[model samples]
Target: MKKGFIFDLDGVITDTAKYHYLAWKDLASSIGIEIDLVFNEQLKGISRMDSLERILVHGGKEQAFTLAEKEALAHQKNTHYVELLQALTPADLLPGVKAFLDEARKNAIPCAIASASKNAPFILDKLEVTDYFNVIVDPATLKKGKPDPEIFLKAAELLGISAKEAIGFEDAQAGLDGIKAANMFAVGVFSGEELHGADLLVERLDELDVLDLIRR
Candidate 1:
């Protein structure tokens, strides 16, 4: 069977989650909305607008922002995130990820990024690994977010492979849900949490043979 690989960006590719946390933290504070890492957990694998809405709910400020104000606030957080991402380097590729990308190339499997983050392209460019992906899903073009199958389905479409022939790797519950919903095999990269729904779960990418994830 032909196979393709799809990856989620933030936690799966690099550690930009810290930058995401810090940026969101700054945004919340600027608005008098106190937030902590625990609250930030809700933002994972979700779109920026959805994440901002979640933060608003946590701060009890959801009703305070008008549609225009909400958009402006989300833009503010994104600007902060882009600033934080400026420091990324090739070393920022998660341990073993580059090797796996190389392995995919060696084995002739197509790869794509299926992430909820709008800054995915910027980060990939900063890391100098933009060439690895056959397609990078543009979050701005999507009407739905993770836990919805749209992102992975779109990725598989771009790869010209059926969802059943693609393997997706993710580090969050919502991502796993979306991968499975798309009828693709799912692998969860453990990031300290007990992610329960993947077809296969491993602590890191190096633990699994790339060929196994790719075919059979």
Candidate 2:
């Protein structure tokens, strides 16, 4: 039986979250709302529009901006994010991710990306890892966000595997929730702290026992 591994993009495959944070921070600053990393954590695994809404709530500008204005802000933030992403290179991949991809390829293990970022494709291309995926579950097509099973389930289906036979790696609570809610085994990837709710938690991707999962 072949097993599948689905991964979240931002912090799991690479550290583009910094670019996202910088972009969002710039957007907030434009609106005279100062945001810090501590508050930015709340935007993880969220949609672009949702992030703007959260920023408004945090800035007490929720009633100040109309829905259309908020949409424009989201667009402006994405523009900044795209500008930051232009500086990305293959060297920007978080440690061990390329090696992990190589190992999966050598073992003939299928992999797919299940990221909430609409820029997932762009980043994968920018980082030069687009060919590694069997299929990427596009977040734009989904009506629901992470912590919902839709994305992971779609990834599993695209990979031609059962959710039960899949293993998902995530760096956020919402991603973990989504993976488990899909009935797939979850591996929580973290840094400096162990995330609670996964079947296993590891600080880095290389620590994953891919061969063990294959042989089991």
Candidate 3:
């Protein structure tokens, strides 16, 4: 039986990917890095620092950045992202996300959020979905990001559940990898190709029957 649910915050819980893409595009343009949305996809479920490094490397100009220069540019991008997120409203939430959380809670299944964003708590609070989770494993508490499994594992630990009993819901490929690494069942949302490590894939959150999914 399922005991817990670990959710990814960005594309899975809130529609923040567009804002992140815009911020990264702004930063890339400022630094002459020439990053596009395709390149930005590589940064999903990754830390801002790691994302910047990968963006620079992919753009074939990583060596051009000094530590200080990288920090300044990444900070600038964060400023843009935070400003954009300030306009976040409840309507920005993904379809069926709220209902899923509500149903999970009603069913007595524990729910938690595991996100690479250091701003995870802030975004959750803004969306007013924080109360739906019993615990949240965010960037602030973890040294490693997704694909490492530490974040998802920590969420399971916090919810007092075994990894096998926790289902991880994620939108990014990295997050799927993390769930696999943690020995949990992964339910991939949004994209099909990104569900490489997931046990199942759904185009929309509400499309999946939670009880039926857990059975498989």
Candidate 4:
């Protein structure tokens, strides 16, 4: 039975993906690498530095920047992203997100965030749902990012649950892969071909039957 729920913050809880895209696009354009929404999808669930490296490689400028330069670029992108985040409020919670979190709370199901973004806590605070989660896995503490299972595993550990006892929710292919790799039941929130491997697929969290999921 699933005893806990682990979530990916960006797309799963709120729509920070747009802010992320805008920030990355701004950075990419400044670096002469133009990226559209399609390209931004590839950056989802990946670390900031990894995303920057991908953007650099896409522009054939991967070898042009030193590690220090890349770190600076990543920081620049994050600064803009945080600025965009200032507009976020509790009302920014996506459809069914607040309701589902409330249901989870009523059911006494522990919830944790396993996002690749280091700003998960800040985002949660901005959304005013910080109390809904029992743990927010610090991306800085992980040795690897999504598709590596490290983040999700760390979230489960911090929640005082086994990976197998957690149900992981994600909106990206890499996140779903990481959830499965961590031995958790995967719930994909996107209706995309890339999310085909999820054990339970839904376009929104409300579509999931929480009680049934827990009993599985």
Choose the strongest candidate by lDDT.
Answer: 4
Candidates in order have lDDT scores of 0.89, 0.88, 0.85, 0.91
Q: Write the per-residue lDDT of candidate 4 for residues 18-122, one digit (tens) a residue.
A: 899999999999989999999988999899999998999899999998899999999999999999999999999989998899899999999999998989889
Shift in Å, residue 32, candidate 3: 1.4
Q: What TM-score does prediction 3 earn? A: 0.93
Q: Is candidate 1 or candidate 4 better by lDDT?
A: 4
Clashes of 3: 0
TM-score of 4: 0.97
Per-candidate TM equals: 0.97, 0.95, 0.93, 0.97
- In candidate 2, how many Å is residue 75 off? 0.5
Inter-residue clash pairs, candidate 2: none
Please, what are the lDDT tens digits per residue for candidate 2 over residues 1-216? 448889999889888888999999999999999999989888887788888889899999989987788888899999989999999999989898998899898888899999889899999998999999998988888989988999999999999989998889899898899998998888888853347789888878888667876654
Tens-digit lDDT string for candidate 1 (1-216): 648999999788898989989999999999999889887788889998899999999889989989999999999998988988889999998998888888888898999999998788889999999998999999778889999999999999999999998999999899999999999889899886679779888876778787766656
Stretches of candidate 2 off by over 4 Å are 192-194
Question: Candidate 2 vs. truth: CA RMSD?
Answer: 1.4
What number of backbone clashes does candidate 2 have, counting pairs of residues 3 or more apart or in separate chains? 0
Clashing pairs in 4: none
Residue pairs clashing in model 1 are none
Lowest lDDT block of 10, candidate 4 = 189-198
